[model samples]
Structure formats: structure tokens, C-alpha cells
Target chain A: MFSLLLQSFVCCRFLSSLWLSQHSVVCLLLQVLLTHITISNSQHNTPNPTMMKSIVARAYSPFCSVFATEDCDKLANDLGYEDLITLLAPHGDSVGRATVRDSQGMTNTYDDFAIRLGAKRPTERDSGGMLFNPDAMEALLREYIGHYNSDDSAFARFFAKLVAAPPDTAFETFSQPAAHLFCVSSRNAHPLDTLQALAQGQKRDKDCLNFYVLVHDARVEDAENSTQRTIALLERAKKRFGLAGMIKLGQEGVPETIPTPQFLTVGDELVNLKTGVGFGSRTLSQPDKESIRSLLREFTVQHLIPHMERCIMTWDTVAAGKRGLTGRMFSAGKKWLKFGGSEKQEAGSSIQASGIYPQGSPEQTIRRLADYAFMLRDYRYAYATYELVKRDFLSDKAWKYLAACQEQAAVALLMYTTRLTEKQRVEVLNPLLDSACYTYISRLQLPQYALRMLVVTSDLQCLLGPDAASQGATQWFQKLLDERLVGRLGYALIMLRVSYAFSQSPKGRKAALWQLLSAREWADANQKGEMAKCLDMTAPVYDELNWPNNEGTLLTRLKGELANEAKPTSVAS
Target chain B: MSYYLAIVGTEDNPIYTQEFGTYRQGGDGNSRFSPEMKELAPFILHAAIDMVEQTASRTNQLYLRTVDNFYSHLVSAFVTAGDIKIMLLHETRNEESIRQFFQEVHDLYVKTLLSPFYFVNQPITSPVFDQRIKSLAKKYL
Candidate 1:
């Protein structure tokens, strides 16, 4: 989900190779699934499990749902508010900087900071607290994306929903938006009225940032006219909605009005959804690009960052106040164990029998705080906060929450720590990933999540450098194979990667053997090009080696298969 | 118990291969592998050779127990001197007895190697060697 140009140095280096390799597979699978999409409008039905898996995997980015009043929504119907943000975010030359106070009360700055935006269409108003249903929401999204399955019978539909949704509580918690962008289009006649109604209607909450953007169209009106209109709207907004009061409370910030020449540009493909709605893409001039970038930079710097900083402070204080002195001491003691502690000894913090951490409870607050810190790119603080909540989730026997915390904790460490020392790798990252992977795969039976976790962790490990790191990576790749988590193409791709990981390590013969295995898998998958490439890669090691006759025959037959592939395509036997 | 045993030479060449069944606990000794499993067994064992070599390098022990598994079938291995591996693909795990069986096979393998007519990496065609292995499976596996 990361924009290649805007990603942090560490993230770019860590993700580039893995992302490149996975890009083809993910796209190919999506293409295959999209072809199967049936756009029938039948009665309510549960999503297909495999279809849900693919959809869930695609929605891994941090979501920021865009909201607007009816008039603004109608005005920008061609280019939805969310789609506008998505299109502009990647094309910008720079999004500038943000300096925020982390959970540990340390200030950190990120240059060229950007959010990996997803086009999360606005839904009904979130009932103002922690009980957002990610499955229902994602199901809605799946429907929007044309993955709705109408063939499922009513009872089967009910049972499928019952089985699939509840166990994946981690994903539910993650689907909580980092921020919500409310828009008041310049085209709307009563912009001030719409803004006031949206501001008042949106329940003022401390959990997520709710910032406003005045979407101006330069093609309709000049920038000076729109800016004058925006100022007038803000003046009226201050008096009507008491925006100045919200700004003082750190709950809101100054509104931004951004202009675009046109939503659609030349040579852009029109995206047709299941609803038969088509959204246009735009080409931007340099000034338009700069204004869009400036808008984001201003929003992130002035509103989102400050909002998160204030919330972290608020949540930390609330959690600390609830915890009291002895609880603080107990948490400090627990922190000692967090560094190098074994899994068995982490059962110290106990929760009551009810098992639910209420919306504003210290545990829930800290969890939200962690999520915010992660979204804000304050990884160190996020890591610490996640580690803190993990114990509470563990003691409460909340497998989904615990697994999500562990997964985030590992990711935070990878992102924040400049260099991953062997000690940290063994003590911290390994156990976190292992426990998370176990919970996701075994307890939740969410192999898709487990696959994602291992793939990301292994790639991060490989990026940390060769030797022990690459060896660790190879081991994780082997786990993917052992678990049989991927399809045939995925299996072949993983084998090819494992070979590369081995080659990165000092194990030459093992590397060559893995190349051979990869070639064989590719052949099985009927990917003759990849099969030929893998065979060629292993040739240096196996071609003239004094090995047995069988290996020799394997190479010969693989070459024969490639030769046959050239003659005419036959089914892989 | 169904078993597929292969002795792999240093260069990953199979020197000897056999498929047999347990003659213990009122059971007759007859290989019970399904047709698909029989065809897949070679690939499984061959794949485990990578694990065997990797594990063999890490430990000084002759018996590298249960190096890898595919489905319900477990691949237990024993490494002899000169990097040759004795691998057994079987269902269910009886670790101590498997170790004892492997040690006995190691003895037979060594004895076979000591014979003047035999050489390393050559397929074992001796009827006597096959008879001894079946008897060993009957006693221990």
C-alpha cells in the first residue's frame, strides 16, 4: 500500500524487492478473481471465503474514510472525495514534514511524510465509539468492488457470516480509520450550512482526527474566488459551529481549501464498479500538484499530527490515572520482561471474567493510542504501547487483540530501529512474529493473515542484511512452504525467493537446490519462462556436478519440457 | 506400519531403496502405501534430502530424528560417516524404536559397505541385504 516515492528510507529498502516480487502475484490473482466477479443484484448473501481472503489482503492499508454532506457528495459524485485524495497523494512531488509528540513524550519529525491512502467510501455515520464493524464494512466494500456472491442460500449465508466475521477481531480493530476527512465542496451553494451541519452531526470524539477540506474546482472558478469563498465560509463556520472553540480544545484545526483544474485528464482509464458508476482520473499541472501537496502537508502538519499528539497525551494520562501507582510499577516490571521474555512468563497481567475492555477503559485507550502512534510514524512509541497492551490482551485471553498487537509491535520495531541487532532479532522480533503467526494461523484459522505476516517479516529480515538475517528469512520462507499457505504460483514464487535468500546467505549448494526446486514448482505451475530461468540459474552449480543420474535427468527433462513448451502448449502433467 | 526407506550417498544419489510394512502386533508385513502415496513418496524423500544435509551439518549425532514431514508422513534421518544419509519415510512416529531400527540398519549398511564387491553410490542389489532390512523392520518398527 505504500507509495514508492513517499515511503521512508527503511520501508522502501525493506519492501522494494518483496513488493516487486509480490506485485505480479497479487495483481495476477486479483485479475483472476475480478474475472470471476458476477454483478448480480440478489438478496443479501455472505461473501465467499476465498473472495473475502483476497479482498481482506487488498485492504491492508490504513483507511481514512471521506465524508461529506449530501450536497457536497452529489457535487463531487464523479470524483468521489476519497478518490480525489487517492489520485493526488502519489503524484505530488513532496508532502513536506510533520513533527509530533510520541507516546513516550518525545518529539519526532518525519520528512516527506505521507499516508498510504485507500479509497474508503463513506458509510453511515460511525455510531461515535469503538464498536465499528470492520467485517460488515469490508463486506460492503467487497460488494462495492463487485465481489458479491448471490448464489449462496440464505441459511448458508447466515452461517458463513457467523463463521468468518467474529474470529477475525484483529482485522476489525485494525479497520478503525486513522482519520476522517469531511469535505465541503466549493460548488455547493450553502457551503457554510453544509459545513455546520457536518461538524455538528459528526459526534465530536477524541479517538480519531476529523479534519475538513474545501474541495475547490479551478475549472469552475479561479483560485482567488475559491479562496475568498473559503475564508467567508470559515468566518461563518467559526460563529455558527464554534470552530474556534474546537480548535482551542485540540479537537480540530483550521480548514483547508484545495483547488484542482479538473478531476479527469487525458489517457486515464475509467473504473466501472458493480453499481455501474464510473469515476474519472485526472492529470494535474505543476501548480495544481503543488497546491494538492501543500494541502496534504498543511493538513498533516497542522491538524492530523497535532490531533494525534493531543490524543496520545490524553489517552496516556487517562490510562495512567486508571492504572494508579502500583499498576504503574507492575507495568514497569512487565516492561523488563517484554525485551527478552519467553512466552510463558507473560501471563502476569490478569483481567476480569467478563473479558471485554470497555470503550474508554485504560486497555482500550492504550490500544488506540498504539494504533495512532503507528499511523503517525512514531514507531518507537507505537512499539512500546503495543507491547504494553499485548500483556493485557494476553491475560484477557483475547487472541485476536494479542495477535494484532504482536504483529504491529514487530512492524514498529522494524520501522523504528535503524539497525536490527541480532539480540533484538532473536529476543524481540522472532517471538512476536511467531506468536502472532500462530494465533493467526492456528487459533483464528486466518491463513491469509498468517501468510501476510510471514511474507512481510521474512522480507524485512532479508533486507536487514545477509548472514544470520537472510538465514532467518530462509527459515520463514520454509515455514510458508511447510504450512502450504500459498497457491501453486505463490508456492513457485516463494521457492524462487527462498533460493535468492539462500543465495544471499553463504549456503551455495542449498541455494542451487532451492533454485532447482523452484524450477520444478514453476514447471508444475506451467510457467515455462520462470521454469527456464530457474533452471538456468541453477546450471552453474548442478550442470557438471558429479551428482547422481537422477538429478541429471531432472535437469534434462526440465529442459525437455521447456523445449516442448516452445513447440506447443500442453497441460502440465 | 508402512515405511519407505532409502540410503542416499554423499552426492545425493540413492544407493538403496525399499518399501515395506511392519510385521509386529499380529500384523502381516506388506507395504500398504496407496498408489498416489507410492508415486509421491520419492518426491517427498528427495525433498527431505535438503533438510537432511542442513541438519546433518549442524549436529554431530548419527541419528537426525524426524528432519522433515509432508502431511502425515514423517521423514526421520540418520547420517553415517562420509555424509551418506539413511532416510525413512513413515506414518506415525515411534522415535526410540525408530532410532533402534536406524542403528540396526546402520550396522547392516556398514556391513554391506565392508564387502569387497560393493562400492559407495552404487545401488544395493543383494538379496541378503534386502532380507536383513525386512527382518530388522519386523523386529523394531
Candidate 2:
């Protein structure tokens, strides 16, 4: 067959380069000849290439959940390397190349392709179910690479298969509809007030956050229930706020499932909420209020806009930002892809790459998937999706959006994901890299985001090392501390987080205690008795949240502060 | 314009300290610092070490000219091949003259290190070394 001639020519030319003993050279060359014959013979024996292509394409597409492996198969099966080039040309994304010089001063050329699947989000006026999923195309690329090759050939094929896919979104490949988020609770309930405050606070969003308050239906089973007073209080409160459509579980108007337990369903979080809503217009600590405001403002920007923009997205390469590789690159998906018109002569139309996707392909599906993840409280998935798009868009607005995503991702890591493996914790669950990116906020001239990032580092374990500080947490803390615009109590809270991040070991715990005491000092300096009183409450709450290895001294101090509320004096002094 | 010159060793400890004033515009070569300014001059110079350490890793320049500013005062630094640091805190803005003074000081430092009794990062207490730095300050400030 043709492979026999290929084996002979390749061996004769590469024989000297192989640098084998005289006897082994002939032996290796014969082995190569035999292997080629076996492979070519099997391929020739298989009938019907037409049925094979469809089967291969169907198996490689995003919808296919199963993977089949052949131990000794070639890396590029029915889909060779050149077929990938053809895939890009049809979509009109620019096919180009760039040559980079390594540290050794040698230049090597690379196929640099930049693509955007769902960048143009619909404006805020109209957000609907018709969303474009960005990961659909990335999933295709991963599938083609993962399925085509034998295990040993993977190392050789990985570079060619490299695609900035969002983490394996193939599981929910059929774009599902958004689930409604509604709350059910009784009136005069502290948790009800919090949900009401949250609903009123975020009304401007107008998209998503269906924040329904459902007072429990009264006179259950012919007046056997004495829960009538709580219902009446809630009903009066609801009428005062002009809220209609109160829902009860299994009632006609209510959603089958209630999301966000903090809003609905009475909980322990409400026990402390009797004092007040955490965020409001009347708070004297203006900085804490402003910090919370900034957090909410960013939340609206991320949650609302993407929800609306899902309708206007384009899968074609024409919609991609023509600009790439402009600023300090915080992530991948950028390169000087095209030099001039002469690029076609080099790669022949074969290995050419583009950011374009064919119109019917899954790549243009909903970016709303990320927004959905965030709203669903699946921060890990939200982090993955945001990282996918934010790398492509580093504009001032998008970068700030990325900052919000990072902060939320960090919060998700600390609150959840403790039970995962160390490798899983570091890679999928933790936002340590996002913390590194948080320092870039200063470059964007948003100091509030920098302050938020410092607070975020409280969740990062000390084992993550000093790079977390050098990246910007410590430097920004020093900068903000010196400037002192952040409130005294808020500053104390941030310091608490930073000190906690550094206190995974018992030896470091002593130093962390001094930091906690200093937070109380700052609270006292601000002259806010409520903040000073509430400062110690963090330890017991954090303990209940199952955060690891907290110092016992912090709890004792908090309990003492709560017990001494009548006198309000320093426990030791 | 005034100058506060310091020679910092590899361990970030100060090996030398001297104060000088503008010799240009018919000014006398004496420090015009108030009692408070004289004390704060050292603090300003030390605060700039972080800035020096930051900028040093970015470039190979021997004279890291005017890397940090504290209020009205500006700080400049020079890093030697021996990893020693020479810092200058002043109100002046002439980079060329400062570079010239740094090159001369670097030569003098080389000559001082040639002595057998001296150890690296040891306090540079020789009166002759002090006199040479003062002359450079007169020529540059």
C-alpha cells in the first residue's frame, strides 16, 4: 500500500538522525514498515467513508455525552488536522499566524486564532429564553481532541487541540429554561424584612430576581393553626409596601420550588436580623453602606445586563472585537494573529484557524448560562463561565464585571467547596488566581474593588503563600489603611479577613488574635456601639459555617462582649 | 534644594548617612532642614525602599533615578553590582547630575571595598569616604 512507500522514504531520510547502532537501525526500520502496513490494511478494509463521517461528527458534537476509546488509534481519526482549518474558513474568522521568539532567541510560528461566540448581549429592555451558550464550540474542540486519539498520542496532539473551552458544559447541553426565584415567609418575621429590603434594594434590575414574598395562607384545616398573628402582621406589611401576589406552598400562584432560603423559609439567620437590615439608607457608618451599595450595583450590572443581552448575541466571527492583544493580558485568548495579507502563502488553506462558528452550531448559545449559575448560587460554574468571557473582553466595564465575578467566586470558595480534594479545591473550587487578578483593579482606578478584593483574601488559606499579598492584597491594604477612607469598623472587618487568611497554622494563630483585638479597637474608635457589640458575633457564626481551626480566644472575647452589653467596657482593660 | 544621602547594605541596613543642601544658584553647601525635616528625611528615605525593591526587579539601571515621592520630597536610588543600595532623598529634579554623582560614588565605593579590614555591609565610617560624598553633593545638588 501507499504506507509502505511512506515508511521506506521516511526511514531512509531519518535513519542517521535516529542515531542507532547499525544492526538496530535496520531492525527499527522494519518494525516501522510492519506497523504502517497493519494500520493502512485495517483502514482500507473498513467500508463506507460516508456513514463514517456522520457518525464521527455526531459523536464529536456538543450533544454527545459518551466517549469511546481505541487503544492504538491515530491522533486525528476521520477528522484530520486540515479539516479543522476548513471549519474556520467557512465562518470567515481571520486565519493568520504569529512567530514568537523564545528565551533562547529562536523564533517559532504559531496559529493564533481569536473567536467570540456570544459577545453582543441584548440591551436591558428585552431579555428572554433565547440565549447563546459560549461553551458549545469549545466543547466541540475538546471532544474532537479527547475522542480522536489513543492515550499515548494525547501528549503529541494536545497543542493542536488547545481550545479555551469553558469547563465541560456538555452535561446540560440542551439549553434549559430559567427557574423562577420566589420567597415564601410570614409577616413581622425578621427574615421577611430582610427579603423585603433585598427586593426593594434591587428593584432597578427589572430582569430576573423574581423576589416574590409569599405569606403563609391562614385558617389552615378549619382554624387548628395559631399561626394567624404572624400571617396578619405579614399581610399588613405587604399591603403597606403595595406588594400583591402573595404565594403559599402548593397554592395556585407559587413556583414549584423556592430558591434563596434566606428570603423565604424561616431560618437561624433571622435570629440576628431582628436588630436591622444589614444594608439601608439610614446607617451612620456611611462607608459600610457605600461598600454594600457598590457590591449591589456591581451585582445588578452583572446579573441584569447579561440576562437582557442574551438575545442579541452573534456566533459569527464578524461580531468579535477586531482588537486583540492590546493591554496587559490577564488571561489567554489573545495574540497578534495576522501580520499582513501574505499569511495565506505559508499555511496553504489547511491549518488556518479562526474565531468564527457556523450559524447552527452550539457556540452561540446563552452566555446567560453564567448568569444563571450565579443566581443559582453555583459560584464554581459561574466562575468558569465568567473567566471564559472576561479574558476576551478587558474593557473598563467588562473588567469591573470580572472583578465582581472574582469576589463572588472567592465567597463561593470560602462558604462552600471545603470537602473537595486539594487538587479540586485549588483548580475548580478556589479563586486564588482571581485574587491575583483582583490587584488589576487598581490599574482600572477602582479602589473600592481593591478594598473588596482584600476582604476576599480572608477566605484564601495561608497555605496559598505570600504571593497573594505581593499580588495586591497587602499592598492595597497598606494603601487603603494609610488613606483611611474605608470605615473604621469595615477596615477592622477586612483586617479580620486578611489575618484569618494568614492563620491556618496554630503558630500563626497567635498573630491572628492580635489582629482580631485590633479590629475591636478600630470599631471602638469609630464610636459605633452596635458595631462594637456585633464585632465578636462573627466567630460563633463563622464556627457554625464550619470554617476550620479558629482560635478559641476570639469566641471568648465575642461572648464576653455580648454578656457585658449592659456595661460596654473592655473585657480585659 | 536639599539632599539626604544614604548607603544601604545587602541586608537593607544603612551603612552610611549624610545631609547636604543646594550648591547651585549661589546657595551655600549646608542643610536647610528644620529640626523636624531633618528627622523626617530619614523616614522618607526608608519608606522608599519598597519602591526601590519594586522598580529594581523591573530594570537593570545602576542609578534608579527618583523612584518615589513623599509629599514634596522625592527619593532616588542606585543599586550596585554587589547588591548594595545608595539612596538620595531631595527636593531637586535634575536627573543627569544625579546620575553623574552616582557614578562617582560607585567608583569611591569600589575603592573602599578594596581595603582588607572592611567587610561587606559593614558601616562606612571612613572620614575620607564622607569627604568624597560631600564633594559629589556640592558638584551635583
Candidate 3:
């Protein structure tokens, strides 16, 4: 109702102006808009430096699995693998220093090569479980890539949304952990036996690097005893697991290390939103921090980086073999034969039967290869791999898999390429994102994924030298509203986003109009704060047009409602 | 098909208005617009003027096909030299016929403007003009 009134009012104002006068106004508006554009362009109009840095930091981090037996919890006084890892883990800048050569043979030193340590490896349980779902992945990706909250440009927010992974049933964006840490407490009587048992339980892919961690509590146990036991356990693990034989470790450098857990008191029920940790910041002793740091650094430099480098080399060759002309023909022939052999097998079964690609298949290998390249920050290679595999998924009609590939492919390109030409944006990012969002919403019944997709895509778009892309971003936001995919609060929020998008566009009045509409939406959603904010933003525009009295009643009523909301005792009849 | 046509002058005053149903396919030449739509169609055309003006700036073509829409009702427009807008609020899109209708109406409008008694922004109350419009609606609508 408010929008209808506002629209008519705006239309009437527009209608009253003669074409000659309006044309002159449009020309003046364009000149002012062009001046603003020139100023922004002169300021090195790339994405925010911090945002790019954070995206690189997040995307390049390797994943590792920390496996602790149930006995480790008993030793740590009910502190499970998560708490123990948290206490002994080196996070962010504390991960010490590591020097490694990438697959491209460029030597780079990282003082903070951090690995995201998950408690367990990806299992069938995680596939069906609520944890680590597509929405969760999208949220986590947004956090890592950089939050879009501070960006004023609507395209920046949209780009952030576009480049993040779409919700997929198969969790493949973050690669399967390349390094597995088997952690055992010294208090456990048969630590070696538990390590052996746990190691045996794993499907022990040959490429994965296994590290044995002996965790001891400084407050409870003797550090020397734990170190000696760790040495003995390493010898046993070397004999039983054959990790030493596999990697050909030198006698001077043992894979096993003792990390003494330092106690820190943190309030329960408090979480660090940024890190998504169970507890907030707790200061650690400098030496303890250094010890954990050096341990992780050694783990990354000696085992993790080298292993990843080797894997990339091997996968590159294998991918070249498979994706090359002959390999493509061979695969095409194989697929054709399969198509002829199974006349009754519908395309849907390919997705339903193998929720993920069948193990050891070319698609799985390529995806794994892409994941590793992404982890290694070889984004070009990762983007190419994603592009290569996207077609296979498309032909198989694996919509979810195809969408995931498309999302990752776009993200990889966005992360690596600093600037995209108009042609690339239209040809590459646009179609990839459109298909991904469409498939997520239509093929799959995951509107949440579509929302995330649009949100991320808009953020990524904002990064690419803001221009008419904001208009495209606004259209996507409008689509979210039109589809009714968002809740009332989300609707109000996205409407404000649309307003912001328009505000960044050349047309100032359209921005004011959207702001008015957004204010109405906020009022409808009963969000007094946001409604007041939007009204405040639109105030100057209305004042310019002398429309205060025309909108005064609605604004006064809304302000009154806000005042009532602020008070404690406002009961409605 | 139901259509509501309005001839709005440069100052956005309604100079002429008509409503009619399709005369083809066994239909009587009477408007079948819903009572709610009958009340709303004028406002719809009024609201669409903003869109018409915006579209007019982007293109040189006088016939701005379907400038705006309110749900299923599309507003097609034709602009004259003096900035008089002839807007049609219609249910179905008949681009060529509407373009032809707008062209013939433009001729009639020019003839009306050329009259010594007629003036710009003056309402058309001539019965002969009304009869010609009804006949045109029957011939091509």
C-alpha cells in the first residue's frame, strides 16, 4: 500500500516535467554520475585489499583431520578432540613459518600456513548429517572469503555471494583432508595400540600424510615421560603403519611430536563467531604457543606441503592424460557404450545412485585435483579442472554436482583473476552463476542455496570495478523478493540491499525511491530500527522534492510505532 | 480482448478516453473490463506515463511498445510531436494492430489539432470523432 502511494506520487512528479526539461536533468545527472565514476576509477578500483588478502588466506589454507580416540577425552578431563585441538592448535599467525615451492615451481614462504583441523574425515555420516551441509559450507565460505557487510557497493556484496559454493549434497569444495593427525594422550595406557587401531580404521589413501601426535597435559603429567613414550610410540607406528617406510623419513626427523596441552579457563556457552570456536579468546603462555606453532609449521613444511606438491604433480599428469584429446575421445566412447548398454537407465539415477562421483572415477579424481589446486592456491589450475569436470557432470545430468562445479569454477576464477573484461563476465561468470542458482532452486528444492548463491555472486560482482554490474546485482536482489524466497526479515534486508545497489547506480532518484520502498518493507516487517534507518537515508531526497508532508503521516505513524517499541509498557488492545 | 485508451496531453491532462471489447470472434463491441479493473485502468495508465517518458528518452521510435505493465495489463504507447501521449491499457499484446490503431488515431488527432475551433489539451467531445473511433475499433480491434 505504501509502495503504491509512493509510486503514484513519483509518477505524477515525473509526468509533470516536460521532455525538454527532463532531458536536461538527465544529462546533468549523468555528468555528476560520470564524475563520481572517474573519482572511483582513479582510486585503483579493485576489490578491497583486505578482502582480497583474506580470500587468499582462506582459500589457500590446507585441511587436516585431527583424530583422537575416546580415551583422549578421559585423559583431558572430558575435553574432547575439539577442545584439545583448540588448546594445542596454532591458529592464524601462530602457525609459525613454512617455506615451500608450489606446483608452478615458485618458491614462497608463509609465516602462517594454517590448516583447518576438522575432528574427523568426511564420512557417509557427514553426507546425511545437518553439520557441514551446503548452507553451512556457504556460510563458512563467506566468512573465509570476507564478509560483505561493510561493502557499500551492492555489486561487492553480490560478488561475495556469487563466488561462494552453492549448497551441494556432496561436500567437495574443501578437499578431503590431505594430512591426518592421529592424536593420543600419554595418559592412555596403550597409546600406540590406539593409534594403530585408528590408523587401520581409516581407508588409508596412499597420498594422505599421516602424523602421530602425543598430547600430554603439563599440569597433570611429566613432560619428559610423555616425550619418551612418544618416541617409543613413533617407533611402533613406524613399524606397524609403515608411514616411515612410505615417506622414507630420516632418523634425525621423526614424524611423531609431543604437544603438551596448556590449561586455559574460558567461559562456557561463549563462542568466537569469527573462528566458529566453542570459546572466546584465552591467552596462552608464549612458549606453549611457540611449541604448537613450530609443531604445526614442521607438519606443514615437512609433510603437508611436500605431500600436496607431489599430489598436484601426479594429478596434473593424470588430468592431462584424461582431459587431453585422446582421453576425451576414450571417455566419450566409453560413455557412448554405456549409454547404449543401459537404455533404461535414466539420467537421474547417475545423481541418485552416486551422491558423489564413484570412487576412483575420472570425475572424482579431477574434483580432488581441483580441490588440491585450490588448497595450494593454484587457482588457475583449479579453475581449469572445475571447467573440465563441469561438462561431464552436465552430460550426466548431475545437476547438484554440475552446480557445485559451476560455483567453484567461478570462485576460482574470481580469486585468481584480478580483473574481468565485460566479455568474460558475460560469457564466464554470468552463465555459470545463473545456471548454478537456477539448478539449486529449481532442479534441487534448495531455495536457501539459491539465496546464498545470489548473495555471494552479488558480493563478487561488487569486487569487479563497480559499474552497471550493480544494476545486475539489484535485479538479482529483486528476484529474491519476487520469488518470495526470503522471510519477512530477509525480505526487508534484501530490499535495503536493492536500495543500496540503486544508490550506487548513476540514477540518484531511483535510489531514493528504492530507499522509500525499503523503508516501507521494514515497517511491514515491524523492524523499527531498520525502518528508521531507511527513512533517514531517504530524508535528503524527500526534502529536496519537498515531499515531507506528503509522506509525513506514514513517517509520523512509523516513528510513533518506533517510539512505542522503545518503551517498556506499550500494550495493544 | 478489452482495452482502455486515453489521449493525455503534454500537461498530463486527459483530453480523450474510450473503452471497448473485441468486435471479432462472435463478440459484441462492448467493454468487458471487471468493475475493479474499470476503476483501476485509468490509474494504471497514469502510473505508466513515468515509464513511457523514461522509455521515450532511450529510443527515437514514436511507438513505444508495452512501456509498462500492471500484472497482466500492458500499457503500449505512442508519442506525438507536441509530447501528447496516447496510452492503451490492454489485456493481450497485439503489437502490429495496436501500432496501426495508434497510427490511424494519430491521423485523427492531427486532423483535430488542425481544426480552427480545437486547441491543445482540449477534450474531444465531437460525436463524429467518437463515431470514427468506434468504427476503427470495429474494423481493426
Docking class of 1: incorrect
For candidate 2, lDDT tens digit of each residue in A182-259?
233442236355555645543242223332333343324533342555456556655654432332221222212111
> Which window of 10 residues has the lowest lDDT sum in candidate 3 chain A?
A261-270
Strongest candidate by lDDT: 3
Tens digits of lDDT, candidate 3, A152-219: 43233333333322122353546366878887765678877888788888986887888877665444
Task: Provide the fnat value for model 2, as a fraction from 0 to 1.
Answer: 0.00
Q: Give the DockQ of candidate 2.
A: 0.03
Candidate 1 per-residue lDDT, tens place, A187-305, comes to 67876667667666766655766666666555453656766766676676656643221110001233334332111111111133323333223333455445556766666677666
What's the lDDT of the predicted structure labeled candidate 2?
Answer: 0.42
* Chain A: TM-score in each model: 0.65, 0.31, 0.70
Model 3, residue A91: C-alpha shift (Å): 1.9
Q: What's the C-alpha lDDT at position A525 in model 1? A: 62
- In CAPRI terms, model 3 is classed as incorrect
lDDT of 3 by residue, B1-141 (tens): 888989988755778889998899888989998865765565567556766788899999999998876557899999998899999998888899999999999999999999999999998999999999888888878
- A best-first ranking of the candidates according to their lDDT comes to 3, 1, 2
Question: TM-score for all predictions?
Answer: 0.64, 0.35, 0.65
What are the per-model numbers of colliding residue pairs?
Answer: 0, 10, 22
Candidate 1 Cα misplacement greater than 4 A, ranges? A1-63, A69-112, A116-173, A220-282, A321-325, A328-357, A394-400, A410-505, A508-566, A569-573, B25-30, B34-59, B104-139
